[model samples]
Target: MKILVIEDDRLIGDGIKAGLGKMGFSIDWFTDGKTGQAALAAASYDAVILDLSLPAMDGLDILRGWRQQGHDEPVLILTARDALEQRVTGLQQGADDYLCKPFALSEVAARLQALIRRRHGQLQPTLSHGAVTLDPGSHTATLNGEPLALKSRELALLQLFLLNAGRVLTRAQLEEKLYSWDHDVSSNAVEVHIHHLRKKLGSQFIRTVHGVGYTLGDS
Candidate 1:
């Protein structure tokens, strides 16, 4: 999934970027609130990691603006403020979840996964299509009960396909979800990934709609 992280602290921001990246998420990070908010407006994201304390604009204000403007992507507030009132206010402003500072990367990832799942109306933790099963929390997958060894990008792509099982996804849509702004993606990046996935999971696992796009096929 793609995520936007708006944080001022360099240490925290870098840690989040690296940690989440390892977990198969494409992360776009900005230190200033205005820049982060603008990034959200420019592209699609599965979720947002927002810090209450921000430069140029406050996190709550950003969240309020997004909600008012009907940007319904899930937002998770991660801040140092631990007061009950602050937490309530954040949620009231439309934060889907809240995590206090000095937090674990695992917890943050878990919360983000939950928010994404809820947004997709997915009630199950593991995503499965036929004999394929993926556990986001464990960063693991199994094919026919055997361990599936997949690179991070491949794993993320599979997850995206599973999330939108019946919908046809264009190459542009796949690129948007799979890459951050900083990535200089090649023209055939998505094709290469799709080819790799088909080789590993079988060509019938993903069906191509002639003159259109691709969709998850019967497994």
Candidate 2:
């Protein structure tokens, strides 16, 4: 998924970008809250990594403004603020999850995945439909007990479909999930991914709606 990261710390932000990218996500990193807010207002993101303290604008105000503007996407607060009251305030202000600094990179990826899943009302780490099972941790998909070889983008597309299984996902929604702001997405990017998925999972698993979009259904 595409994630918007708002962190003033260069090291932390770079680590998050590289770490999450290795886990198969498109990332857009902003070092300050103003640029982060501009990014949020301009495009849609699958999730956000927001730090509590920021330059130009504080993270709390950014969170509050996003909520006021109706950006309900999952947000995971990443900050050095570990006090109970600080965490509570962040949650109350609309952060979907919280993580203090000095955390394991693995934990950040796991928690971020959890927030994304929860936003879709899915609690399970792995998602399955019919003979296809996707494991986020291993970045693998199995069909009928055998693994399906997939490229990163293909896997990302499949995960998005499986997460919102049975829902008609628009082209715009799929694009937002697959490409970040800095990434140059082709006009037929979603179509290309869908075509590849059909080639592997069988055409029946993904149903196309004429003049509309695609949906994950029975195989």
Candidate 3:
């Protein structure tokens, strides 16, 4: 999944980026709200981590603006512990969840996962299709009870495919979910990752729609 994090605190933002990247998420982080909101307008994201206190634009304004513009992507607000009123206002303005300062990466990740699951209406953390299973929290995948060793991009593709099983995902969609903005994505990037995933999970696990894209199917 692709996430946009708008946070001014470099330490917290970097931690969120690194930690979430390991769990198979592609993150594009902006330290200021103006750039963050512009990025949201220009691109697509599965979710967003928005800090209420921002330099150019307050996080609340950004949230309200997105909501008004009909961008209903899940948004988790970041706030100081003492700002209960502001946190409540954020929720009223369409924030999905809130996390206080000095929080653990584990908790942040867990909350993000919960928000995503709720978006998909799935309560289970493990995603499975046939004999293949991928766990987002642990960054692990298994085929028929056998653990599979995978690279970062490979794991990300597998997770996306499993999450969107039975749907035809175009190359653009795969690329969006698999690579962050900073990553240089070659023309064949998606194909390469798909190739690797097929080798590990079996060729029949992913079916091509010819002119369309790929879909996860039971073999």
Which candidate number maximizes lDDT?
Answer: 1
Clashes of 1: 0
**Tens-digit per-residue lDDT, 1-219, candidate 3:** 889999999988899999888877899999998999999988878889999888999999999999999998999997784477877888899999988887888888778877877787678998888888888777788999999999888887887777676689999988887888899989998998888888888888899999999998774
Candidate 1 CA-lDDT value = 0.94
Task: Return the number of clashes found in candidate 3.
Answer: 0
Best by TM-score: 1
lDDT, residue 76, model 3: 91
Worst 10 residues of 2 by lDDT: 176-185
Worst 10 residues of 1 by lDDT: 134-143
| Model 2 lDDT per residue over 1-219, tens place | 889999999998999888888788989999988999889878778789999899999999999999998889899999999999999999999999999998898888888788888888888889899999998777899999899999888989898888887789889888887877677888998888888888998988889988788898775
Give the Cα error of residue 156 in candidate 2, in Å: 0.8
Per-model TM-score, in order, reads 0.97, 0.91, 0.93
What is the C-alpha lDDT profile of model 1 across 33-125, one tens digit per residue? Answer: 999989888999999999999999999999999999999999999999999999999999999999999999999999999999999989999
The segments of candidate 1 whose C-alpha lies over 4 angstroms from its true place after superposition are none
Give the candidate order by descending TM-score: 1, 3, 2
Question: In the order shown, what is each candidate's alpha-carbon RMSD?
Answer: 0.9, 1.8, 1.5
